[model samples]
Target: MTARPPLWRDLRVIRAAAQVAALVAVGLLLYVLWFNLTNNLRRLGITTGFDFLDLPSGVNVADNPISPGAPLRRTLLVGIKNTFALVVVGIPLLTVIGVLVGVARLSTNWLVAKAAAIYVETLRNIPPLLVIFFVFFAVILQLPPPRTPLVFGGLVVSNLRITVPWVETGPGADLYGWALVGGLLVAGGVAWWRTRVYERTGRPHHRVLWAISILGVVAVAGWFLLDGPIRPSLPVVDGQRVSGGFSGLGAYYAMLSALVLYTASHVAEIVRGSILAVPKGQTEAALALALSPFQRLRHVILPQAMRIAIPPIISQYLNYTKNTSLGIAVGYAEITLIVFQAIGNGRPAPQSILLLMGAYLVFSLTISALVNYLNRRLRYVTN
Candidate 1:
């Protein structure tokens, strides 16, 4: 066999050719996109620059407290905050509920398994927007109007809003902060102590109980020392309005609940599949060792299952974050809505849309990065 060309020479030529071809393709694609964008903007009399971002976004953002006179950038920021709020709150709630439902679907009880199965099937089939509408109309709007709100102690649940107690910040704020710091230290100490006890005796460690007791002791002591610095901001009925306390507007609750329910269905499926993917031998081994189902799930099955579950669950989370834009349909004033409003009110459509896309892209990539880190940490490592 003739070695016509040395390996290095041949590889170098191939690499050079591939790089040139890839660069040509990328250049052409960018050229086309730029051309189309500028051509369209000029045709529509819209500026293609970032200057529009400085213009006042002259529209009242419903449910947002920001002034309409604020710059377009501020409006966009408020919208981003609203979107982030939904995702941050919804993700944890959905994940917990989904995990419970997924586990229930595997329960020995016929009723529980079937009920969980029904919920997953029903929810996953429905369109998310319809679910949002249903939640808003049937649950939120159907409640008694703001005048005669449902009251349970300091809490008031109304058609227009739900109000709950919020501690009014007082002069003893520093005391409360120190109490929180003390609680953290105490909780950490309790956890460390529990670990030591578990190591020494190989007994069940009630780490949660230990941590809670420590934190509770610190908090209760701080409460008395602070001399009732925090008090209830109760909701009061004022004619046609419910005032006082922190209110969750009907649209906010509706949008959050809808996304949570929708995302939970997908998360439930992922949990079920991940759990099932865990080796049957692991479950059997736990049983052979006389482990209770809860202990087996907690210690043996879940750790393994979580490795499988996290990647897909991360995707669901990203999807939920992106889906928060759907809140615009119900007037929830999320990022997408604000972008559209800005464009309508003389902000350049191209630049505003680009910014909106960039925001979502950043949110998605950040979530992916976090998930990748967790995946690396959890992945099986063998020497």
Candidate 2:
């Protein structure tokens, strides 16, 4: 336009030049910060590299089999595993409890509604660290000692540890496991097929029952076909020590319980608010159709509420995962605890901290990515 308004004086050219200048300034600032950090570390005689990852950790993690002679890399892996263990179990339990409490908060029964309100108010108001301490000292530590543990079939509980029945892998277990996974895939396909049929014919699909039955049959058949490659192992207590099934450290339970209760309180509130946000017209329409309360909720309300709830729940999940670092206070060997342990043992503090941050960053990003994917799938498609 008019010789591009002389390129140097053009608004577009000036904007581009400004952006380049800003980017260069930001890059220079970052470089300067890095240079200062390196110089300071060098003067302090602290190694800033990751070569220490290959060296022996010289410390054994509780509830893990990592030897003191194992490399720091292995130690960190164990820590990551422990953190994952907390998250994997905590998330589902929290979801179940949160949903129950959330629905209860809206119950017709005054007692139930009040009780849920009290729980949500109390727990959410408390600091998560305080919850962790309360769980550790006032609850878990208050259990009977290991010498006289609570015993209920395959489960054992004590202040020292808790143990539960778990599957014991035997020969061909891997193959059988893979077969079960294939069964799940088949079941999912069956569910999708049922969904399509229901959409087309307006029939009762009972997709859940069909999927579960398919999965169960395949799993049972695979178990027999593989000659029982997995069996249940019950916990056995032997005078202050437990063996046979899976054993959880007291710290694990404390961290898990505290985080679940605290995070679930937030999740409960989110869920309750989401449910309330659903348009009243939708509920009235469902009622006009003579739908029972449960049917109304299951078919008309929950689906929409969940779409709203999931994004916030994803944030709560990340919060719980990060709060797990507080396990250090109770002696759980999560990644943060492990990093601090290494640092105290003369490892390079900066590198260990950098790795620790990276570990958590990876965890958060992964959880966010997965939940965001689900959110996208659940989102309403507007034409």
- Which candidate achieves the best TM-score against the true structure? 2
Error of 2 at 287 (Å): 0.7
- Residue runs of model 1 more than 4 Å from their true location after superposition: 1-12, 193-210, 380-383
Query: Model 2: which residue pairs collide?
Result: none
Q: Which digits, one per residue and each the tens of the lDDT, describe model 2 over residues 1-383?
A: 44568878899999999999999999999999999999999999998888999999999888777899999999999999999999999999999999989989999999999999999999999999999999999999999988899999889999888999998999999999898899899999999999999999999999999999999999999999899999999988887788889988999999999999999999999999999999999999999999999999999999989998998999999999999999999999999999999999999887788899999999999999999998998898999
Tens-place lDDT per residue, model 1, 119-174, is: 99999999898999999888889987877878898888887778887766667878
Candidate 1, residue 179: Cα displacement in angstroms equals 3.0
Cα TM-score of candidate 1: 0.90
Superposed by TM-score, candidate 2 places the C-alpha of residue 294 at a distance from the truth, in angstroms, of 0.8
